[model samples]
Target: ENGEFKPAYNDTIKDYNTILEMFDRILNPDPMSYTSPELKSVFSKFKDLFEKHYEEQKELENSYQVQSNTSTQAIKAKLS
Candidate 1:
C-alpha cells in the first residue's frame, strides 16, 4: 500500500534535513560569522543548491508513485 512508503520517505526527509543543517553549521560556524555578507552569500548559495536537489528528489518520488499506481491498477484489472 502507499501508506507503507510514507515512513521510509519521511525518514529520508529527516535525514536529508539533518545533513543540510550540519552542513550549514559547518559552513557558517558562528553567528558573528553570519554577520559577514560574504559568508551569508556562500551559505545562501549552499541553501539554494540544497533546495534544488530536494525538489528534484520529490519530483522523482512523485513519478515513481504514479508509475506504481498505474502498474497496480493494470494488475488489478488483469486479475478481475
Candidate 2:
C-alpha cells in the first residue's frame, strides 16, 4: 500500500500483528532509506500459518459431520 513498500498487515489479523509489533521501528524508519530483511522473512511465513488454520478447520467440520451421523443413527434405531 505504501508505494510497493508491501506492508504485510493490510486487513488481516495475522498480518496486523506482524505490523503492530514492529510499529515503533517502522513508523520512524531510518532514511537509508528503509528496509528490514527480518520482517520480510517473517511475513513470508504467513502462508504456512494459514495452511495450518485450513487443516484445523477441515478437522472440525469432519468431526461435526461424524457426530451428526451418529446421532441420526441413534434416533432411527429407537424408532425400529
Candidate 3:
C-alpha cells in the first residue's frame, strides 16, 4: 500500500467491473431505448478507451512482475 498507484494490480479488477456494468447498460436495450445517438456514441468511445487502458495497464503489470521475479532470482543466486 504505497503511495504509488498500481493500475494493473489495484485498479484492473475495479475497472473491469465498471466495464462490465457499461457493457450491461449498452446491451440492455430496454433502459437505453430513449438514449440519444450522440450519447450512445460517447458511451462506445468510452468503452473503447477503457479497454485500451486496461490492456496497457495489464502489460505494465506483467512487465513489473517479470522484472521483480528476475531480480529476486538474481539475488538468490548471488546469495548462494
RMSD each, Å: 12.3, 8.6, 10.9
lDDT of 1 at 46: 84
Best by lDDT: 1
Top-down lDDT ranking: 1, 3, 2
- TM per candidate comes to 0.58, 0.48, 0.69
TM-score of 3: 0.69
For model 2 the local lDDT of residue 19 reads 49
| Cand. 1 Cα-lDDT | 0.76
Looking at model 1, the pairs that clash are: none
Per-residue CA lDDT of candidate 3, range 1-80, in tens? 77977543345455577766756566454653666678778787777887899899999999999999999999999999
Error of 1 at 75 (Å): 0.6
lDDT of 3: 0.75
Which portions of model 3 miss their true places by more than 4 Å? Answer: 1-15
Q: What count of clashes does model 1 give?
A: 0
lDDT per residue as tens, model 1, 3-80: 555422345446777767766765666655444668667777888898899999999999999999999999999999
Per-residue alpha-carbon lDDT of candidate 2 for residues 22-57, written as tens digits (9 for 90 to 100): 653553455664647676555546545755787799
Give candidate 1 regions above 4 Å deviation.
1-34
